[model samples]
Target: MSAQLTAPQTPAAAPAAEPAGRRPRRGTFGLASKALVNGLLAISAVYTLAPLAWLLIASSKNRKDLFSTSPYSVGEFHLLRNLSDLFGYDDGIYLRWLGNTVLYTVGGAFLTTVISVACGYAFDKYVFKGKEKLFGLVLVGILVPSTVLSLPLYLLASRTGLVNTYWAVLIPSLVNPFGVYLARVFSAGYVPGEVLEAARMDGCGEVRTFARVSLPMLAPGFVTIFLFSFTAAWNNFYSSLMMLNDQNLYPVNLGLYAWSQNTHQQPELYSLVIVGSLVAVVPLIVAFLCLQRFWRSGLTSGAVK
Candidate 1:
């Protein structure tokens, strides 16, 4: 009788131990799923980074090594030599082009952001006659391609004796309809009515309230608009090409295009052009990396509601 009771208790204990063993299998399956997801992300990251890595490596090599050496391997590192040769190749024209790009980007971006923000804020806060009609017009403007308008704009600039000048490029770039639309969206989300009401009740003037209260709230939107305008101006090729006849006024994009055209005739310039392209991309990367935190926060703040 004692042996029978002991045997029954052992069978019950075995069933309990079996569940404990099965728990590890379930944990392992979960870990495997996580591992698979992580691996895929790693692969995607590598694919995205590969081109940038190649650009860096290629830029380090000179003309001879660039063509002959392995694309992945670092060949006799001559980045400084390449940069010096790049700057001195044509009476330091590259430096001038860089300066022109900076000026265009900074000037165009500043004016565009200010104008867009003002337009957007007014559209959001003010209730005036023809508001919807005007906004509809703005939407139509957004749909109109910049390329199509380029010819008309060029003609107008020529008539005004502004063609081939910086103003011609700067003025058109400042009137970005898309930027205005983005600004309106950002203003609607960021600038709360309560805050504006509070400011007004405190005896603040409209302009004063906007500068102190609204502008601070719209900083992230301003940064976003600035970056968009800056990138567009920096990369603008057709407008710059059409507007300017002088080499001194050329931005880096047009300058690079000129070099690329000559590459077929003077193949040595091929390496220089490649190297220059690699160098040209660095500022954009740096700007994005620096401003990404603010951008992320701003986007998320608007999205959370």
Candidate 2:
């Protein structure tokens, strides 16, 4: 017996470990995607803001500098002079236009928001016959071009003797089918049935429940609707043109349009129009800045819930 010639068995070699530095990088793909998205957004932003930048600069330049100088170049700072001229032109009629715009936008937007939100809340929370049918009609109304209704609206206003009156503009502004649709969506998301039921169970009436309980929760929706309606009313050119013949009753946009139309005959009015447009843009900017948070939240209401 040759002392049990059992050879020692060697251990199997271990698999080679991959290098840490050579690991596949996920950050590369992520960074590239982010860069692409950011580039597109930056381009879009420049496209959108360029006109506004032009407007701001042009608003500051005197008439000679407006056309003679480069568009993006700084000219004589005539913003104050231009504003003075704008206010003094035509016996300060620009103020009248601004006042009219404020009146129409604030009054009409408030009423429209109220009506639309109420209708939407009812549509969302209440049970009734023909509810879906009525909402479908609203959707149909949204599809109809606003311009198409202009003739009929004019005729109706004529029949009722509302033509060339504030009512003609304000009345039409109050009927916002899109606002109603948005309100219904917001109501569905922001409001819960249980809270409404609890309010009712506490002997709260329908109107009271809405006013005290639900309306508070619907603040974001209301502000959103109001902003939309306000912008529409502020920029309401065609309607104001058809509805108002009195220069004093014209909103800022329509008044500026009138000035622009007369620019061929009165070259100085070009400056006035430019300056007035800048003034007209201020309120809208302020409103958006103030309500931006609520507006953003309102927009995302139904997106999550």
Candidate 3:
């Protein structure tokens, strides 16, 4: 056999090694993105907490320290004294305001949650004429700022003789368009259609089905809505400002605002405002801390099923 005398083939040129400087580094972009996000979050946290920090520090100081020291400085800790004066001021009116705030927030939030969740359930489950149209209207209401509706609400309250009464605030608070929208979303996500069908097959009426099966399943959503409504009603300053002239009906926010306005005339009120504001924040913090588990579950439940 003829020897294979083929010319020795040249080795295939190795792929030119990419320059080390030009090689893509794994995770460089990812690390850069993470750093950027962390930086932005830190900035946002600082911005949000700075005023709160000032308030906290200032609340501990007397008026002299407030003016004499830096805003962030710690002065003579008089927190208990401040609380005593705050609750004792003006015939213990702060207590009354605190009570009113609780009533408005708790009662109104409960009612609002029920109504909103019911409406949302109806929107999701029931097929009625003009259903989408009505929901669209609700969405329109959401687009309309609450401030814009205050005038109309005030006029309606005046005509009905509700102005300056608890009803004026409570009634309007019960009609949260956004809450209704949220309820509908939650209903759609949390409730399965088959469950309703099974309930109906078991001879359960619509209301009975809702109350027993549907509502129980929607607990996370319920707590979420309650928290939102509570926060909104708790901080309901503008509505109270517009609707109420009676100081007796004031919520904590409105009362604190009033104290802030009077601080220029009564220098002692500065301490009151600081301490009152501090007190007002406690409820919201407590609410979140207590109910955060439910809120978290509500947010994540519908995502999967």
- Which of candidates 2 and 3 reaches a greater lDDT? 3
lDDT of 3 by residue, 130-156 (tens): 999999999998898889999999999
RMSD of each: 7.3, 7.2, 6.2
Q: For model 1, state the Cα shift of residue 138 in Å.
A: 1.6
Worst 10 residues of 1 by lDDT: 296-305
Cα TM-score of candidate 3: 0.88
TM-score of each: 0.84, 0.89, 0.88
lDDT for each of the candidates? 0.86, 0.90, 0.90
Model 2, position 29, has a per-residue lDDT of 87
Stretches > 4 Å off in candidate 2: 1-23, 296-305
Candidate 2 colliding pairs: none
lDDT, residue 47, candidate 3: 100
Which segments of model 3 are wrong by more than 4 Å? 1-24, 298-305
Q: Model 2 — TM-score against the truth? A: 0.89
Clashes of each: 0, 0, 0
lDDT of 1: 0.86
